[model samples]
Target: MELRDIDLNLLVVFNELLHQGRVSAAARTLGMSQPAVSNALSRLRKLLGDDVFLNTSKGMVPTPLSERLAEPIAFALGTIHDTLNSKAEFDPATSARNFTVAMTDIGEISFLPALMKRLSEVAPGVTLSTVRNTAVNLREEMENARTDLAIGFLPDLQTGFFQRRLFSQRYVCLFRKGHPLAEQGITLKSFCAAEHVAIVAAGTGHGMVDESIQRAGITRKVRLQVPHFVAVGHILQTTDLIAVVPEAYAKRTLEPFDLETAVCPVKIPQIVINMLWHGRHHREPGNQWLRQTVFEEFSS
Candidate 1:
């Protein structure tokens, strides 16, 4: 294949197809029709003399050649975009860019409101959307620019991702304002005896607090299990069950329900919350502004 035969636009389509894994989705992302993307893929195949992607039951699965080409193509495209955009000033006050973030339910409660308020004051036209930071597809979403930022306790993000620590939080037990445990500070014995509500944030039955207890050879009677921290307040306010939650989140959410917070009886590691982004957007002006805004708000 000769350089003259390659269309730079075809490379763009190929990169999008690699990220999207389907011609239709790639078309949607590229603002092109499905047939246009398909034709571009065909052109790419002829130029490279390789069947770059194979249609599979699971969508477009890239061949070995396509897989090898993906990283360099994506990097070159990102560099071109960043180099061009970096010359333009990022005026947050007037720009109407939309940013997508991924975080757990706890992040929605603790961070979103304040971030929105700040954005409203600083960049009134800017908008934001939040999605769950499920363990399964976070890396792919970030790599593909589907999620602009992810803020949470993500210890699983690997290479090609950058992170900044927002804050460190420890476990706190939350209960109703007048719960018996609140009257006389909680002890390990009382904590173990009480019926607790465990939050399985990652769909795992055990969390950091549970692991701590297990390490100490102690066990607590978990009377209820919840998948989100938002439900814990309501359950604790109405029942005798207590919940172990992040200190920052509990401080913000528990107050509305007239709840009280106490330090966890078991020793658990401090949860370090971080804001993560992909290297692809590291130098892009809009993404830089967003990252700076978040850092100023949460890192302080």
Candidate 2:
């Protein structure tokens, strides 16, 4: 393929078509007419020497070459978009931008208030929305720019994504402050024998904590399982069942409800929380501002 012969804009259209998976939908997304998109696709196919896409009942299925180029092209286009978008100077005081983030309920509990407070003081018009986190397809969601950022411990992350260590904290065993185990720190044997309130949801790594315990030849009987940390309090308050949770959230939300946490009796790895983004926005001015703001806010 001769670099001078290929229409560069057609590559952008190709990317959009691959992403949207339909010519008409891609046209709508790019704000171009369907014929125009089709024309761009034809040009792109001719230049690349591939069918690129096959129209099927399911939708546009990309050829192997198109599938292979999808990620790199998307990343490259995203970088160009961020670069061009930032050519206009940012005035945070007057600029109103909506940033949608994906975070766990506990992250919202720990960081949203401070983040909003800072935004109100510095950039009042800026808005924020936090989406629920799920186990499956999160990487794909981020890659497609559906979620601007994700905050948590994502294990085995892929290349072409950026991650920054936000903070790390040990897991704490939470129970009512005056509960029996709270008086004396739980022993490994006692902890393994006690009833637990586990958090179970689709696509969570926390399930591994249970697996690790079993691998150690110890078993902690789980009496109840809850989806979110906030719900753990309600269950802990009424029963002797203990819940293992992140120390930061435990310190913030559980204490008021007469809950207290102690170092876990068994050896568990410290949880390292990180903020993640697609490399496309690494140098974006506004994204840099937001990232630094979050880092400063959380570090304090």
Candidate 3:
């Protein structure tokens, strides 16, 4: 490939094409028309003296040259983007910057309200957007600067990521304060005998709550199952069921749901929640501020 002849703008288009594998998809993502993307590809081909991609029944298949060029082009683009975003100083009060966070529904319910409240006091112009932690490739997105940070029990983010400990808490049995089980407190017999509402907090490592309970040779008769923890507070309040939830999460559920919690008779490992970001963003002033704000607000 003729590296000196490559137009930086067309390289952006080429990278999108390689990722999406279709001209229309790349065009839509880049906010350009299909013909514009096709033209860019043509320009890239002319510079290289070979077709970078070929239209096949499957899609636009990359030529050997394009495949070879993908990595370095992506690295160059990512470096440029990161350098620009890494301001020497950040003034959140006046800067109209936006950040995207990847988190589970539980984080939305427990953390967002307080975080937004604080941001309102300090950085009213800054905005936040959240995507489901499991819905996308989080590591890739963060590395590319498409996502700013992630928060939760995401064990999969171990490699190539930096994390700050928020807190760790054990599972507790939670139910309405007025429930019959509240009178006796939670004993192993009462906990197992009671009907329960189970939370299937998919992809956030929250399923550990249930798995640990089962491993303890104890099982609650789960009468209902919900996909997220946003509803756990509501369900527990309105029913006679109990749920095992992280102690920190249970604290948030108390007043709004009029709930009470007791130590889980089944001892389970504590869950450690963290705020995670890619190393590419480690030195950015805004990223630093955001991490500090979150750690101060939520960490124990």
Stretches of candidate 3 off by over 4 Å are: 1-87
- Pairs that collide, model 2: none
C-alpha RMSD by candidate, in order: 15.9, 15.5, 15.6
Q: Write the per-residue lDDT of candidate 3 for residues 1-300, one digit (tens) a residue.
A: 456766899989988999999999999999999999999988888888889999999999999998998999999999999998975899989978998999988788778999999999999999999999888988889989999999999888878799989988788889998999888888889888999988887787778778888888776798999887878888888889998888878999899999999988887888889999999889999999999999999989
Candidate 3, run of 10 with poorest lDDT = 1-10
Compose the digit string of candidate 2's lDDT tens values, residues 49-72. 899999999999999999999998
Pick the winner on lDDT between candidates 1 and 3: 3
lDDT of 3: 0.89
Candidate 1, 154-222: lDDT as tens digits: 878869999999988788889998899999888999998899998887732226777788899988899
Instruction: Provide the lDDT at 131 for model 1.
Output: 86
Please, what is the whole-model Cα lDDT of each candidate in the order they appear?
0.87, 0.81, 0.89
Model 2: weakest 10-residue lDDT segment is 201-210
In candidate 3, residue 261 scores what lDDT? 92
Instruction: Compute each candidate's TM-score over C-alphas.
Output: 0.71, 0.68, 0.71
Ranking by TM-score: 1, 3, 2
Q: Which runs in model 2 stand beyond 4 Å of their true positions?
A: 1-86
